[model samples]
Target: MAFSAAESKLVSIFCQSVLYGVYVVLFTATTYTLLWGNKARRSVRRHNMLFVSFLIFVIATMHMATNFSRIVLAFIIHADAPGGPAAFFNELSNFTQMFGSTLYVFQTLLGDALVLYRSYLVWERKLWIVAFPCLLLLGSTATGIGILYAFDKVVPLADVFVVQLGHWITAFFSMTFTTNVICTSLVAYRIWTLNHRRKHGDSMRRHALRPALLLIVESGACYSATLLALLILYNVDSWFQYVVLDSVSPIVGIVFSVIMLRIASGVSTEEGETALLGESGVVNSGGGGVQLSVLDADPDQKTVAV
Candidate 1:
């Protein structure tokens, strides 16, 4: 489908405006949830509070970078009247694009780290849990270097691959989605086997697996929506639809914050102790009174909710 010059200009303006609006909303929600949310301060939750906080900051940065990029593009398009201001804006846009690309690499790796951490918790493995984050760091650094090199060497290829194909690939094959499914499947298999063994009896193991189950399902749903959007609408000029997808991260962030807050606020005694150790994390009190903790917590640690 081809767009007339006027139509293309209108679409661009609409996209830029929507991006700016979502940018404001996302930054506000992220700041409030991290800084002043009651659940955010709890000491007993199992999720990595520091990592979550860091993720929030990264999301904010992403939004800000996008917003600045949009503003620069808008200025360049409408800069019929020339001045030093237009030249400065052009330079600023170039810088933001570089920074934004770097941050996107970090975001991808961070998602992978979270997935690995969650998987380790399910398997009750100490080694995998420790190794995954280190692996992610190395992977991120290498990917960042590769992206920089590609960006510098092949302009057309980088624009198509990095700018367009990157989002398309990630929307479907993101580390978060892949890991969540794998971990959840493993957990489900275990739950099924436990249930089979207890065909004529009751098992507490089923209860212990509930939180992981819920998290897996939720992550799957969010990723599914994102994937659908990418598949069906990403290349289309449906500003409204793209905005919906763009807004997904912040909305997911808020939902996660709320659920986490609830869990943090109601940690059990054993779980609280576990939280302090920094090994196994605690989900809030619920589901047949099962208290789950990991074994890899550092003995010197305190303040476990994340």
Candidate 2:
């Protein structure tokens, strides 16, 4: 059956509501992490935590503001009233759709940057490895801005219209999707490779932090899956696209915030702990990623004094 206008509105609102619910809960966790997790860390760690919290808060506030705008627009231009659908759609085409989506796009970009940074660190700060994602990020940013600009110039349409500027929108999301996939895969691979290098006791080493890598990998996977879903939904030419898009910022913020929170709380494996404590210099496995010790089959190379 074809989705009714009311049904489309409901889907967007319901998804928005649920995602905001996730945001509120994450903000609560973020508050706790800020209060307790930064107690003993170096100034840099504390500062980094503050920065992450600030970014996540910005994203949450932006999503909330955009949703409020939509609600107000819906009330003002009741789609079911006489000539209401035309007025409502025209307003959307002229303003609300682009404005609201711009906030969503920026939020996604911030999330993408976070993962890319992590991947860069994971790869021992290998500039060449991160070059492509950084370029894609820049392209995504430019295209997103272009889309917003185009949205304003286009005359309002009588019906919900997507196809005219759809290719540009698709390009932005595709770049975003690819960037997330690459970063997530690199970070996860680095962690898995680190663990795989050891024949045993990765579980027992600095037991407090062992779960951190797992958390990072799992969160990366979850967010990557969401990006893939959003890309697919966007291509479907339905209102359901926003259903996925609206939820994205909060999801990305929550996933990355949780990882940072855990890290702040000192949940790290031995190598991570080594990096955190400055025991060994920049082994990729240590989470420092600046200087990497060459891995070898020999026992001596494996035992580089930490």
Candidate 3:
């Protein structure tokens, strides 16, 4: 059975609303924890995470609001049109739709950049390590902008499956997905390697690093998996892609907040605190000297102490 455009959009908005509700709950809990929870306060990364969380949430909220207004415009304002809501929805160049696309692209860029930044941090700020991913990020940015530009020049009632637009959209999705996968893998590998090399009396630190790696991979999977699904569905011209697309903004927030929440919770544990201190490697002897723990296998390798 062929799913009408209007039906697809309705389903998309419905799913988005449900997911946005969940996002709101998670965002609230995350913000509260970051602001007042004792566990979250001790994390060195708290402020940066909190700020990004708030920004993602605000963008998501605006996305949700834009979609809501789109529903109103399509169903009520255009009720008397020839084909009703379906016809209205077919107009790919609608202002609200364009704005929604802009929001999605912006959120996606932010999410990818966050992953890149974390990867850089985990890899000890090695520029060479992130060079390829940086190029991919640039590709994503360029292709994303190209998509919005194509949206403006497209016909009022045109669909997204057109040749030029489809190509740009596909490129954008592919680059962003690649960027995320690469960055996530790099961070996870670095942490795993460090965990494997820890010596005796480092069980606490091992425990801490293990969960950080796990949380990172798990959270990254959420976004990357959804994006892959969207990419495939879009290529297949499935109307169901609308549902996935609409839900992505909130998913972004969910993933971002969940990671911070888990990290904060983990850091609150005794093992995690000991691990953090160990990683910090501050010693107070008679001379008051400082000690730095080496994480890399090669002693001569210039690497930041994890």
Candidate 4:
């Protein structure tokens, strides 16, 4: 299982190269979204905004840590002579891996939160809609972590197998796909119901549904691609898996940035305003912000001061 000096150096270089590429793409996309999108300037739904931002930071940190580890590994592998520096690099790599695992948990949690938040928006007060998903995600994440800890410092084979399975179900495939599907279906159903109930041609209904549709489609595509990549990696060896999985974060980050930007840009039309805010004052519309009260309410009817 030992690599020759030249082979080790080559592998290290390749890993560093792939990691660097991921870092660059993710940083670029995140930076673009932050700069061009008015997410920071405008008010938004507290939960959605906070969760999305948190996810972005976690993904960024994960990539940075992975890249740093690869750089250290490269240095260790390519060192002309082995000494204190090699030992330091090895230790640093292990530290990065440990921290990376923790970040991965945060990443999964954030994704689940995003889905739960969407479900909350869709089925307001049907608390179970959000609660069930949150509970499932929490259980999945906890189980993954427990499995990894069960085989702590023991060559990582068991940990990797358990984690990879968890990722396939929770992180890469099921959570994203299934959640998006339910949310999208609910949003579409709401749209259809609104359209059917309207007396006249409701332009507003269409406008309001646009953003939700866009989000659903974009998220669906992104998750689908990520899942495909995961499937491909599952059939590959360790080296290929490392390269492919390492490439995933940057792509996910980019997709997130794009979706957030679209949200920040405001996808709803004037006709869609009513669709955005349900009869109950909750905004069922896409993206952040909730309507607590109708802006067009009669002033004379509600003169009571708060």
Q: How much is the lDDT of residue 206 in candidate 1?
A: 33
Backbone clashes, candidate 4:
4
Could you give the candidate ranking by lDDT, starting with the highest? 3, 2, 4, 1
Question: Candidate 1 lDDT, tens digit per residue, 189-279?
Answer: 4333422332212222334454344434323345435535543443454333334443444444443443344334333121111111124
Q: Candidate 1, which segments miss by more than 4 Å at Cα?
A: 1-51, 75-93, 126-141, 156-158, 162-177, 184-220, 224-252, 267-306
Deviation in angstroms for 179 in model 1?
3.5
Flag clash pairs in model 3: none
- Scanning candidate 1 in windows of ten residues, the lowest lDDT window is 268-277
- Residue-wise C-alpha lDDT for candidate 3, range 255-301, written one tens digit per residue: 77776665554432211111222333322111222222322223234
For residue 114, give model 3's deviation from the true position in Å.
Answer: 0.7
Q: Give the TM-score of candidate 2.
A: 0.77
List of clashing residue pairs for candidate 4: 45-289, 204-271, 204-272, 208-272
Full ranking by TM-score: 3, 2, 4, 1
Question: Tens digit of lDDT per residue, candidate 2, span 88-134?
Answer: 64454445666667778788888888888877776777889999999
Please write out the lDDT profile of model 4 over residues 14-90, one tens digit for every residue: 65456546645655654555455554345344345446655565675565566556456546654554443333333
lDDT of 1 at 288: 37
Question: Scored by CA lDDT, what does every candidate get?
Answer: 0.43, 0.64, 0.74, 0.46
Model 3 segments beyond 4 Å from truth?
196-219, 268-306
Q: In candidate 1, residue 253 scores what lDDT?
A: 48
In order of listing, the candidates' clash counts read: 6, 3, 0, 4
Candidate with more favorable, higher TM-score: 1 or 3: 3
Candidate 2 lDDT score at position 70? 68
